[model samples]
Target: MTLTKDYKVLSCDLDDTLLREDMTISKYDSRILRELQKLGVNVVLSSGRRAYDIENRFKQIGLEKDGAFIIGSCGCEIVKVDKMEPICTKVLSNDTINVVVDYAQKNNLNLGRNLFHYSIFISQFKEFYYSTTHLVYTCQNPYNLEHLRITNIQPLKVDYEAIRKMCLESPPTKLFITEDPIAVSSKILPEISKVLPLSSRALITKAYFCEVIPTDGGKGPALQWLCRNYIHCEMDEVVSIGDSANDVDMLEMSGLSFAPSNSFDVAKKAAKEVLNWSNMESAVGRMVNRVFFNGTFLMTDEEKADSKIE
Candidate 1:
């Protein structure tokens, strides 16, 4: 059955949801999104990525020029693209940062491995930081670095002293930690939670990444804030697409939600529909066709027959 409900806002996650496996938005998908925006839909790029990273990469699609919004850092930041102005932001307090520092020093989960435990510092500067004992060094999450190559933005390395100074002088939007997936799940996750204040929260956004931000900040809350104050839309009128645990909040709140076939179980369970196609197969484009174009946009008979990925 064709969907009859009206949808005004299209909130989409970037990685493994709207973007292809190649870390780019396909031409077909980009065209569909542009068309949706032209039709007066408020297209929002909601992602766990930093706002700069999202804007730098997506500006090529011209969504910013069309008055789109960006909810970045998994919801710690919200920006209106056209004006390049922040609508809302949440930051980890200095006390919270101090606590995290102490925890990291006391619990050296990666001690003596000679391997870097990369972490990102999200703020005015897009910097990547890592630590060994009491000394902090510059590093990059190799996976994130691959994506940053698209933007040509260099990852800055800083010392532990620099991080401490920043925390005291100007708090950051959030702190990101990346390490071995097994260690992240087993050790880092629980220990970090215990050290953080009730006002601060840590969540595993990906298999090897844990992000710390203000307790009130998250994709769900950010979506709610935008709808209530700016977009003036109901949660039920929003269409959300995501593929990770971090997307669960926004997915559950949307009236129409989708997860790609390759999505994590949590995302699939949260979404109303799970697409047949994976990200590499133009999942976003297919979903756009099915929902907005009535399953006919750019669909050849052969493609339609092969729509379901085995």
Candidate 2:
């Protein structure tokens, strides 16, 4: 019943695992995590999201002082939630950034930004993914400029100077290129990978998003680093939860792993068990209940079908 039997540290994805589609944490899930933290468990947020966003999320749930750590930028950086400062970081070299920019410009492909705290994405076309009203995803808008801090990349000519300056001044912690998911996966990624310096790496985080970071940066390795350097625990004391292709490595590295019923195939395959509820239904609370209390982790087929029921 006690987590002392296994995990001492927990790493969870931010978007789909902990936060709801509205980017808010449920009261039930928050209560479970806060209670677990009070019981001496180290809960960490692992995400491709920027450090700024993670800090704000912790602030939103009043966990900024609850003893938390963030493996941000898909493991390119780590920050302490209490301090709001990066403990360690890995960034793509300036030379590498220039190379990528040059390639994108020559090909007329739009690339995202990787600033110190957040990533920037501006729609270069009318139908870009982040612009999807159904998705409601954006780092910056005029109403919340201070928090979003994203560099607009629209109206190509106007943004050119600003974009160039940002690249020269900001070393990318992790950069992304957004387009038609189909084009990104099929033609763009393969062609770019062939030219990137061997020191850099790129992968698909979403259908319309391809993330570029240092070759050594990965969420699993970052989790390992956190265990060794920050938490002082063995890999066996760690638990990971995630829900996408990007979360595959972190899921694989954990002593215990779980994915929502609605998670992608790869993430589910990486988990030792699947939760009875999906994220919208607060699957995270159920996961914590199973881990820290005498709670069930299994689901019947009917219950599974009902996970999607409104």
Candidate 3:
């Protein structure tokens, strides 16, 4: 699809969308984003990733100094490109956090603390309690309930009952319950919805982990925030791309949304168009080049035919 200046912004999810499996951006993708900037199109990174994590990856892409916008920790925080100052922030209350921690301890489940700023605090026995706690931290889930003291942790709380009610009423931006993300999201989400109301617009993205945020928290809201606050652009002027459920919201909201052939079925269904290539084939790069520069960098039919034969 031909994108017009009305779509002057590009918002995207990170994992399984902009980044390949190795958590790296392809050179072609990086170049296309820079080229889009040259066309005065704003590129915004919208992700559940922490600000630092997103910033580090952008640095690797050699675009860290390009003044891109980031929506991190879901839509709870927004940061300008290269600037430490945040334009927005949302935090849960400490009492609510205490309640969650206590419930997890009582249930023999692992508890992880997201500071929403610097570090993620996990239970000492995280390994036993959570399947992939080891990936995020060195300490295991706490074995002893005696050590479950809550102190000095950044105080944040969300009314579990209220959140549950909200989730049920409306879809959450993202819902994360256990380390086996798909299982929890599929099984637990409906159960949680029994108690909470979810946003109708919420899109669930399952990974090794799950997180709960606003239904609008996906790339869509982050991009909207950037366009209104930073870029002064409109929604119809942007193009978005991704490969998973978390990308659904942005994909639907964008003037044009592209998904790789390898994207999840749900994501592909939501996209306005599907790219011929997968992430492994640098599909994001191909779409960016096509949309922004009218460049002809996509792989040829012969290349695909050769690869399939190999």
Candidate 4:
């Protein structure tokens, strides 16, 4: 069965939706993505990841090219790929970040730090190593500066004071708090919500990671903005796939939505349909064939058995 509506944009979630468990896009998925772009469909990578990392990751799979856009930092910014600059962006205020920082210190949670800028001449790079509990910067100069290596070779005392100073200089895209999942859900998030301003919004992006951004920032809002301004399409002309709390908004906003077999119950409820195949089995590729190609190619025995058109 053919889709009732023609989709113009495919806004996809990164980690557990498009990329497999091994953190690689399958060849089948990559080919479908390329084929979509060739047919004048806009492919937007909407994720909680930093835009820089998303571009780099897509480059490895040979998907980074012109006409591509990124909704990064969980919708705080939108970047036009070829330009390498954000056509639109929103950032947390210094006062807001300071409040969260104080709460983190009081709760004994690790606050992930990142530099707002990366300059080769200054011998600095941005990092998103969210797993590290210590406050450290792994400085690697792109130009191969020998002197810079000595300072970053050992973990410096980049304490809370450093984070405050950095925030004053330039506000961060988002603030991340990492702690035990139970603590994060039970005590940390609820308490911190009372202290933060009403304009601030927070969500659990991962089991142990809570991300705070502007109230208007999120994958759903970002996609709405892109549809109205960039792509010039209605919300009903978009198809999306994702599998987490962060993906709920985008799933609800799309014309057609899909959740993998392993997705959270909340995500599955939000999606229009749940695929039988998981991410590892190229769920995105199979869905693409069914939606755009009318199930003409790449059908497996399991998929044929499970196939039911909406």
**lDDT top scorer:** 4
Worst 10 residues of 4 by lDDT: 143-152
Better of 2 and 4 by lDDT: 4
For candidate 4, report its TM-score: 0.81
Worst 10 residues of 2 by lDDT: 127-136
lDDT of 1 by residue, 143-182 (tens): 4454344334445556445565656666766776666778
Clashes of 4: 0
- Give one digit per residue, the lDDT tens place, for model 2 in 172-273: 676666667788789878988988887888887756677788888888889899889878998777888888767888888889888888887878898888
lDDT of each: 0.72, 0.70, 0.57, 0.73
Q: How accurate is candidate 1 locally (lDDT)?
A: 0.72
- Best-to-worst ranking by lDDT: 4, 1, 2, 3
- TM-scores for every candidate against the unseen true structure: 0.81, 0.78, 0.69, 0.81
True-vs-predicted CA distance for residue 66, candidate 3, Å: 5.3
Q: Candidate 3: what lDDT?
A: 0.57
Local lDDT at 197 for model 2: 86
Clashes by residue pair, model 2: none
lDDT by residue for model 4 (1-310), tens: 3332379998888877887665677777776677776777788888887777677656765665677888988888888776555777888987788898788767556665445444322225332221212223222222112212311222333456677677667787787776777877898778888888877877876666677888878888899999899889998999999988788889999999999887878789999999997787778888888888777656555544433212
Q: What is the C-alpha RMSD of each candidate to the true structure, in Å?
A: 7.0, 9.0, 10.1, 7.9
